[model samples]
Target: MQNNKSAARQYVCKRRSDKMKITVRVKPNAKKDHIEAEREGEYIAQIKAAPAEGKANNALIKLLAAHFDIARSRIKIISGFSSRNKIIEIIYTRKQ
Candidate 1:
């Protein structure tokens, strides 16, 4: 039998983590901005921004922030700032 009170408590008190890392393959100049896929330890992100003047990088951060349901300031690109494949770090997040 389902205990309504216990289920409600669990749902209301979900665990939240402070940080996480994500490996992302960014596709710049795509028709639209979206997440293409997710693998064992990586994610594929597609954005409409061109890969120039840090535009694509910025777009990737925004896309990731939205995807993870976090603020833009909480997302940081940890590596591969100059390549299509990048590693992102998300801090102070609550994932359900």
Candidate 2:
């Protein structure tokens, strides 16, 4: 049989070396706040913040940091700063 597990492991290792991009779809002013991973590299974030004064953005970074178990400083909003659809960057450095 083909060693697919090893190949998959290698793929994950490569991903850790590269900057991971997460495409987020935000719904601000939601009744409740939550984060969902719709699919790989895609997320849906329902924020209670009113999308004002960068509060929503801050919430997003905080949520992502907790989900990825990384520091807030490592996650950045690379684009779509003022839009519902935003691109978030996460730096993953695998501890080998």
Among the numbered candidates, top lDDT falls to: 2
| Candidate 1 C-alpha lDDT tens digits along 1-96 | 122222221111112467667677788999999884454446678889999999999998888778767889998888889898787777874447
**Model 2 clashing residue pairs (backbone):** none
Evaluated with TM-score, which candidate comes out highest?
2
Off by over 4 Å in 2: 1-18
Q: How far does residue 11 in candidate 1 sit from its true spot (Å)?
A: 30
Clashes of 1: 0
* Regions more than 4 Å wrong, model 1: 1-17, 93-96
Q: How far in Å is the alpha carbon of 27 misplaced in model 1?
A: 0.7
**What is residue 17's positional error in candidate 1, in angstroms?**
4.7
> Candidate 2 residues 1-96, lDDT tens each?
112222221111114464787778899999877888665566778998889999999988988898889999988898889998888889977787
